[model samples]
Target: MTGKSLADYQKEYERIIFFDQPKKDILLAGLKAEMEKQFKLPTRSKEWKNENQKVIAMYRKICITRML
Candidate 1:
């Protein structure tokens, strides 16, 4: 694996670790605020439900076919 991808994953792991250990609502709110500012997104996009259902359906089909 390339060092670039490893660095990316390490960064993600550190963010997850911070979220788990802090368990602070204020900290989580700040993170969300920053993301919204940087991405110019609503942060809680209404399309998430439709998007989630599509992703779950894709996974279900894959698991069903692969297990057969």
Candidate 2:
């Protein structure tokens, strides 16, 4: 995804985390799935690999935070 779209998704994720009233589990699951789907893109470039790693780390952090 482009930087703008990624930022948009991050904003939505923050909303779900901080302000959404219901179905947080469902929304988070969907977001995780979407990120996994996007990560299927070939990681041939160093820059792409770095960005993908950052996103995966972010996902993991979200999961841990939700569990806590």
TM-score for each predicted model, relative to the true structure = 0.32, 0.60
Model 2, stretches more than 4 Å misplaced? Answer: 1-4, 19-22, 41-51
Give per-residue CA lDDT, model 1, range 33-64, as digits (tens): 44335434343565763655543343343334
For all candidates in order, the CA lDDT equals 0.40, 0.65
Looking at model 2, report the run of 10 residues with the lowest lDDT sum: 1-10
Misplaced by over 4 Å in model 1 are: 1-23, 43-68
Model 2 reaches what TM-score against the true structure? 0.60
How many clashing residue pairs appear in each of the predictions shown?
0, 0
Report the Cα lDDT for residue 46, model 1.
Answer: 54
